[model samples]
Every structure is written in structure tokens, then in C-alpha cells.
Target: MILQALVDYYQRLLERRTEGLAPFGYSPEKISYEILLSADGGVVQVNDIRDNTGKKPQPRLMNVPQPEKRTVGIKSNFLWDKTSYVLGISATSKRADKEHAAFKSLHQEHLAGTQDAGLKALLAFLEAWTPARFAAPHFSEDMLDANLVFRLDGERTYLHERPAAQALRAQLLASQAEGQPPLAICLVTGEPLPAARLHPAIKGVSGAQSSGASIVSFNQESFASYGKSQGDNAPVSERAAFAYTAVLNHLLRRGEHNRQRLQIGDTSIVFWAEAADAQEAERAELLLADLLDDRPTDEQEAARIRSELEKVQKGRPLADIDPRLQEDTRMYVLGLAPNAARIAIRFWEVGTLGLFARRLAEHAADFHLDPRPWKTAPSAYRVVLATAPQYKDSASMDDAASQLVGELVRAVLTGRPYPRSLLANALMRMRSDGHVSGLRVAICKGILARERRLGINSDKEEIPVSLDKASTHPGYRLGRLFAVLEAVQRLALGKQINATIRDRYYGAASATPALVFPVLLRNAQNHLARLRKDKPAAAAGLEMDIREIVGGLADNFPRSLRIEDQGRFAIGYYHQQQSRFRQEDGADSGNTESTEDHIEETQA
Candidate 1:
């Protein structure tokens, strides 16, 4: 199914002939220099073509002839190759002499009888030129290993772009079917054609080999079934292989300001939309990219994104926002991860564009909280990173965090119960760090609220976005009590203490409340007394607040809490803490630094 869809998309690109897209048997390769040659094969000047607009000189991507799928063997590409093949000099290659010989011989055989000036000159140059000429004043040491192409000295076009060279390329492609694999039924196209012995390389995965990696490969005898070897086991045709790989590369490649790509943890994702109408498909893609990728800086584009997001958040169809998107337009999202020399399928989902937009809408609603933790609606990318250790890179997350990232993303896309591991990771991080920021608490509340709405392994009451001054659940009330105790400590003493009670006892107070709360309560009495002598009004208000929260609970604290209760505890603490700060912030409305979100941690 994946391959068929990819092949169909490739056909769409072919028919459209999208600008800058490479055609069949051709690919966009990075070429650094152009070796200008005279009509008699004498070296003229080596021209640098690398772009210098950025901080460093980057090679320019040019559409050249399809390169060979080289392994450890010595194979040369047509019309273009690196200095090791073109000039027999490289910074690291030890067999430059043999590679240069192979390049010269290959070009000689292909261009022997050509009558065109460009082709004849190129053949003459390859036949007489030696690598020793690289030491000339016109050549520099930095160009020793960079890829180079050929061009006539006085012309404004490359030699490979000449009519004779194009004809030769077409002829070579037509004659490539000799000594092919046996004909078999192609799995991707359902055609009786020659099954490719090897598939093309797929690049752009985060940790894969820079050269490329394979999606379908059978390198070991043990991996084959019933004596079938390599591509014979899968039976994908060469045409199908090229089509699918081409589509993948096109989607994976990044332009100057591309947003179609997103990475979460170790997984690299590419998404697209298709519809009966090509413009509608492009519109859907732009909307999806705006929703999941980086925000645009242009004022008009930003306003459009905001309008679309507002519609989704209100439980309205995304189609209603912009030109009324078609309900039947399809959306495809595929994620790739690296596995040695092969690529692993982390996730793939296909659905209607409207359906995906609605899924994103639900995600926005699920993450909602009182006192928003972020200026923009949080994406699945941020949610996954919240589970990783603070200051650590997402691409190198631990095994559990990496596994949870994919599952949580699937949950958001499919409206599943949000893998129980999500809540577990949130709570675990809170306990380990002794820091319950508003963001983590919002995540906890989101998990508990969404799971209850779905009726999954939960019989708990609805967790509210703000503080509940009248709840009887022990976990909720205890969380409130813990926040109150910490507040008392902060108020009696200023905010300059070395470590507050939260830094000392949050984990134990949440898990084994029976053992920890009694001591906290005793300490709170001393603080209340000290406050009563100095600030009578504030002390009385705090005492009543403590009495009211404790009155909701029964006589004693529970010995321990279940997983759900732990999440509720975090939510309750966040709510009470934020509610307290909001009151203080209101008193000093003119001061922007009155809020306590920054003092907690970066999680906010």
C-alpha cells in the first residue's frame, strides 16, 4: 500500500513536471565546481560554483545523470564525478589513480564516435589529461575532493546540457535492460516485469548513513525465504523502485524555508496532501504544515494561520476557515528512523484532510489548561520533548522516552487513549526533579481528563482546568494542602531560602502522604503563629484556606496513591499554585515580573 501510494504520487509529479524536480533517470546532486575545457582538450580554468551566500560555501544542487549505486567497487558516473575520479586527487581516498582511470575509460567508450563539439572536446580531454595537471595555478587544493562537471570555456551552459550529451544519456538509459533480473510480478505496480535485484538508496533520515540507506534489503542468506534472495523475495520492479524512492527523496529534501518536514525524538517525518484538484492538494499541505511545523513570520501568513487555528479550537471544520477545504482530500504522513544500513518505518497514517485537521483540533482541546503554559498551542513535538530529561537533546532520548514518543504521536493522530505511558512519564519526571511546573501539571491533567472522557481504565471524576475549592478526593485535597504548606513557608520567610519544602519533600508528600503530611502540618503551625503576630490579616486568610482544604479530606491521609491519583495530585498542586500567584499578580497588575512561572523551571 505504501509503495503504490508513493508511485502514484511520483506519477503526479511527472505529469506536472514540477519546476526544479528531476526527471526519470536523473537526480539532484551536489556539484561544487565546473572544469572549463578548450576545444582541443586543454584545461582552461576551474570555476567554483558553490554558493557563498551562507556562513560557509555550500555546494549547488544540479540535476545530473543518475549516479550508479556504488558499493566498495570502482564505478564512475557519466558526465560528472568528484576529483578522485575526475582528477585523481582526494583528501582521503587511497585509490584515486584507479578511480580516475576508470572515469576516463568510461567517458572514452561512450563518446568515441560523437560528432558534436562539446562531446568531442570532453572525450579528447579525458583521453589526454592526467591527474598531474591538478597542480597548475588555475586549480586549488580545496577543490581536490569536491564534485566537478564539464563545460565549454566560452559557453554559458554545461557540457552535459548539450544536445549530443542528452541523446547519449537517452541511449544509455534505453540499453540498460541488458543482463537484467528474471521477469516476475511486480508487487508495487502489479505488472509482469523484471524484478530489480537491488533497490535505490533513500536519504534524509536523521541518523542514517549520509551517503544513503535502503528501505528494502536482504543482505544475508538467512534473511531470505524459500531460497529467494534479495529483491527476488519482494519482487518490486525497477520502475516502481525508482518511482517510490524518487517520491521519498523529493518529500525529504529541504528547501531554503521548507516546513513539510518535522522531527520528534529520533523519527523524521514527512507529510503531504493529495486531492482530485492539484491546487486543493497544495492548499491542504500548506495548512497541515502551518499546524505542525514552524510558525511563519510574514504578517499575512501568520494571520491566516491564526484564523485557521481558531476555527479548529472552536470545534469547527478546518474547511470552513480557508476557501472551504474539500472533505475528501486525502492526507498522508510517514515517519522514518535509522537502523544501521536500513530505514525503519516508525509510523504511517493515511486519512482525509478534514479528518486530520479535526484530530489536530482535538489535540489542541485536550492540552488546554487554565493559565496557558505556552503562547501557542502545544504540538506533539513539544509534548514528546517534555518527557525527556531537561537540557538533553531530543534526538538522543532514552529507550523508554523514544518508544513513548511514537506511541504518544499515534495517540494524538488517531484519538486513542494516549498510551498510559504518557501519564507515567509526566509523573515520573515530576517526582525525580522535585519540580511540578504548570506545563507538566497541564500534561497530567490532560492525560487524566482525556482518559476519563474515553472511559479507559478510569472511573475518576473529571479533573478541572482550575482549582476546585470543594473537592473531597484525598489526592486532590492533599495536593492543595502541600501547596498551602509551601506557600506558608514562602510567605513567613522571603523567597530567598536555599530550598523550599517542595525541593525537599514533594515526591514523598505525593506518594506516601500519610508519613509526610503530619510533619508538614506541624511545621505549618509554627509558620502560622509567626505570621499571626506580624501580619494578622494574611495569617487569618491562610489559616482559613488550610482549614477549608483539610476539612474536605477525611480524618487521615492515605498510605499510598495509584497511578491516576498521582496524576491528579500534580494537577491539583499546579492549579492551587497558579491560583495563588494569579491573585498576587492581580494586586500588582502593572508589574510583569509578579508571576511565579519563571521561578519554577524552564518547563513553564
Candidate 2:
């Protein structure tokens, strides 16, 4: 189904060139060098077809025919290849001789037999060009690694662009019609065509091989069944193979202004829509990029997303919000991760644009909490990073982190319960870091809320948007009490104290409250006494807040908390901490102070 959808979209892209879709082609390759040759086979000049100003070469995509199967022997591209094949330029490598021989044989069998004047001219140039002469002064040894294309005279006519080159390509394709292996019904199109022996390589996945990797491959004899080998075992036709690969490569191609692809953890995610209207598809593409991007560049973009999300939540028609978009447009989001020599489909989602938008709004709603002075709602990326251990590099996340990201995306798209491990990881990070970040607290709340929606733990109390004075969950009250104690210490010792109560007891307090809260409460009395001498009114306010939280808990703490309740503990702490700030200022101040300073000011 994925391959067929891609092939259909490929045909659509080909048809809607100027009206809506960008012009693209199958079997096209981006080359970095264009070798301009004269009719008499003289090297006019070796042109660098890449932009040299950047650290990497910026190549141009050219419409050239490609081979269907991976070739172990030298098989020349339609009109472009390495210098060894196009100009017989041999490097010190042993494969250069074989490449030169293969190029000579191919030209003699194909181009030499053709009557096209341009191809004949190109042949004549190839015959006269030699490795030693071409490399002596004009070309370097490193130049042999770059792709080279032939140009006839000053007309700038590439061999592949000539009429005869097209004919030669058709002939080559037709030759496979007679001597090919037994035909099978193509699974993609339900047509009787030669099954592709090897599928094309899929590139642009993070950590995949530079030469690209295969999504469907069978190398071991044990893996083959019914005497089928490689791609034949799956039976995707050549046309379908080309279509899917070309479409994927086009989507994956990264340019300075490209926004269709995003790297999430270890997954490379690409999104596209199949719509009858070309303009609708383009708009859907833009919307998907905006929805998936966790950290958009500017405030204006964030506001735009928020506005769109509001419309989605309000049940506005997609066409009403953006006339270019259609609610019924079929959209696909594929997440690919590198797995050795093959690519793994980490996640695949198919749905209408409206459904996707609504689910995205639900995803945003999960992260919504009482106002945090420090930030707006967190992006998915921020929430995921909050689960990582302190000071750990999130880019090189472990298998667990990768799985969490993949599952999180799946939950957002499908409206499923979030993975249980997400809550566990967030709680772990909270314990490790000794503080709950706004993003972390948001993630915990989101996970538990979804868990309730999915009926995973329907009986559990919901974590509130902010401090709840009437709640009686022991873990929640303990967390609130712990926050009060930290505030009292901050007020008593001044803001310059090296470490607060959180720095010492957050992990134990959240997990085993009975083991730590007694000691904490005892220490809080000394802090309260000191605060009474210095700031009696502040001390009284802090005492009342602590009493209200404990009063709901019946003045008792739980011996231990389950993982879910531990999440509640973190949320309770975060809400109480935020509440203190709100009570003092009566408004959400967008403060940028460190966590310690912020906690200390909550006392003030």
C-alpha cells in the first residue's frame, strides 16, 4: 500500500509541474561536475558544477537514467559517472582498469551503434580521452571520485539530454523484456510485470550508510522462501520500485530551504499528502511541517501554530481555516530509522488532514498546564529531552529514548495512550536532576491524562493545573509539603544558600516519602522558627499553605508510591512551586532566573 501510494503520487507530481507541484523526475541524480568536451575529443575544461563557497559541495540535480539493480561490476550511468568511466581517467585503484574497460564496452555496444550525431560526437571524444593525458595537469587524483558528465562543444548539450540518449534508454529497458526471469503479479499494482530483483536504495535516514540502505532486502539463504531471492520474495514491480524510491528520495533531499523532513531522535520523519488538487497537497505539506516542528524559529510562527490549533479545537473546517487545504486529503507520515544495512519503519500513520489536525490539537492540550512564568507550552522535542538524564547528550539517545520518541509521535497521531515508559522516564529524570522543569512537569501530566483517557488507570485522581488545597493524595501532599519546606529554607538562609532541600531529598521524597518527609518536617521547624524572627508574616503564610496541603492528607505520608503516583508527586511539587510565585506576584512573570533563585523568590 505504501509503495502504490507513492507511485500514484509520483505520477501526480509529474503531471502538475507548473500549476502546483515542483518539477521532479525519476532516476534523476545530482552531479557535482560537468566535463565540457569538444567534438574532436579535446578537454575544453573541467567545470566544477558545485558551489565552492560552502563547506560542502552544492550539486545540481540532472535528469539521468538509473539502473534498477545494484551492480557489482562497472555499469555506466546514462550520461554521467566517475572520471574513470566517462573519460577513461584511471586512478591508482585497481577498480579503475575494470571501470575503464566497462565504459569502452558499453559505448561500443550502445552509442557506437546509434546514428545520433550528438552521441557519435560524444563517442569520438571518449575514444580519444585517456587517463594519463587527462590527469597530467588539468585534473587531479581526487577529481576521479567526483561524478562527471559529458558536454558536446560550446552548445552545452549533455549526452543524456540528446534525443538519441532517450532512445538508447528505452532500448536498454526493452532488452530486459525478452530474457528476464519468470514474471510475477506485482503486489503494488496487481499487474503482470517482471518483479524487481533488488529494490532501490533509500537515503537520507540519519545514521544510514552514505551509499544508502534498502528497506526490503533478503541476503541470507535461510530467509528466502519458495526459491525466491532478494526483492523477488516480496514481488514489487520495477515500475513500483522506481516510483517509491524516486518519491522518497525527492522528499528526503535536503536543501537550504527544505522543510519536509525532520530528525526526531534516531528517526528521520517525512510527511506528504496525496490530494487531487495540487494546491491542496502543497498546503497540507506546509501544515504538516508546522505541526511536527517542535521548535519553530520565531514567535510569529509559534503564534500562527497556536492560532491554527485554536481553530482545530473549535471544530472549524480545514477549508475555512486555510482555503488551500482540504479536510479529506490523504496524508502520510513515515518515520525511518537506520538498522544496519536496512531501514526500519519506526512508525507509519495514514489519515485525513482533519483527523490529523484534531489529534494534534489533542496532543497540545495534553501539555497544557497552569501558566509557567518561564516558558510557553513546550514543544515535543523539549518534552522528550526532559526525560533524558542530567547532562546527557540527547542527540545520541539510547534505544529507550528512540522508542519513546517513536511511540510519542504515534500517540499524538492516533490518540492512543502514551507509552507507560514515558511516565517512568520523566519521573526518573526528575529524580536524577533533583528538580522538575516546566517541560518535564508538562510531560508527566500529559502522560497521566492520556493514560486516564485510555482507561489504563481511570480510578486515579487527575493531577490539577495548579496546587489543589483540598486533594488528599499522600504523594501529592508530600510533594506540596516538600516545596513549602524548600521555600522556608530559602527564606531563612537567604537566596545565596549553596543547596536547598530539593537538592538533597527530592529523589527519596518522591519515591519513598515515609523515609524522608519525617526528617524533612523536623528540619522545616528550625527554618520556620528562623523565618518567624526575620519575616513573621512570610513565615505565617508559608505555614498556612503547608497546613492546608497536609490537612487534606490527614497529616500522614504514604510509605511508597507507585510509578504513576511518583509522577503525581512531581506534578504536585511543580504546581505548588508555581502557586507560590503566583500568590506573591498575582501574575505570571516571565522570569529567566535559575531554578534556585526562582524557588527562593517564591518565598518572597
Clash pairs detected, candidate 2: none
Candidate 2 lDDT trough over 10 residues, lowest sum: 17-26
The sequence of per-residue lDDT tens digits that candidate 1 reaches over residues 1-604 is: 8888888988887788865457777777889999888999878988899999989999998888878989899999999999999888898999999999999888888898889888888888887877777785778898978999999889988988888888888888767755676689999989998777888888888889999998999999988999898999999988888888877887888664555677777788888777776788788888888777534567687677777787877877665777657867888888888999999987788998788778877777777777666545655656755665553222225533775666767777787778777788878877876657656776787787788788875565678776788677788888888988988988888766788888898989888999999999999899899888988887898898899998888887899988888888887887777777878766432222213344432231
Q: Summarize candidate 2's per-residue lDDT along 422-492 as a digit string, tens digits.
A: 78887887787675767677778888877777788854677676667777777677778888888899899
Candidate closest to the true structure, highest lDDT:
1
Work out candidate 2's RMSD over C-alphas. Answer: 3.6
Q: Which candidate number maximizes TM-score?
A: 1
Q: Estimate each model's TM-score.
A: 0.93, 0.92
Model 1 alpha-carbon drift over 4 Å, by segment: 153-156, 294-307, 391-400, 587-604
lDDT for predicted candidate 1 compared with the true structure? 0.79
